[model samples]
Target: MFIRIVKMGFNPENIDAFLENFEANKAKIRNFEGCQFLELYRDKNNTNQFFTYSYWEDEEALENYRNSNLFKGLWANTKLYFNQKPEAWSVNKIAEAQNKKPAL
Candidate 1:
């Protein structure tokens, strides 16, 4: 699996617009082929700073998403609100551990 994290900083005045666009497109993004998980995070200290965390089946899957019309259009619209250049990282998933509850 592959993990992706995208960090974005938006103009304070454009935060609402960015959020509205995200709200409208999140479902489609999450449901896209090869996408296994998706989430959004905002910095506590900087309200205009955000991150998108997602898991993909593989690098090809992620590239496919980047090449799709969905992404092209979304990126074009999303870029309009940015205060600075966005940053992103794609990495191979190593491992995940979760706590389990014991029976009472």
Candidate 2:
């Protein structure tokens, strides 16, 4: 699995609009193919800063979603509200929680 973390800093004046757009599109984004999970997080100290955490099956699936019409629309609509160039990172899960085994 792949994890993508997008950090966005928005113009203070556009924060409300950004939230509205997120509210409208969040569900659609979560339902996109290869998306196993989607979550939004905000910096408690800075209301204008937010992060989107998403999990995908792989890079190809992520690229497919990024190239889709839904992304185009969302991107265009949100870009104007950004105060800084958004930062994105892709990560891999290297470990998983497992039940402990009894010592022999």
Which predicted model would earn the best TM-score? 1
Candidate 1 Cα errors over 4 Å, as ranges: none
Candidate 1: minimum summed lDDT over ten consecutive residues — where? 89-98
Winner by lDDT: 2
Q: Local distance difference test, per candidate?
A: 0.95, 0.96
lDDT string, candidate 2, 1-104, tens digits: 89999999999999999999999999999999999999999999998999999999999989999999999999999999999999999999899999999999
* TM-score result, candidate 2: 0.90
What's the residue-level lDDT of 22 in candidate 2?
Answer: 94
lDDT of 1 by residue, 1-104 (tens): 88999999999999999999999999999999999999999999999899999999998889999999999999999999999999999887677799999989
lDDT of 2: 0.96
Off by over 4 Å in 2: 96-104
Q: Clashing residue pairs in candidate 2, if any? A: none
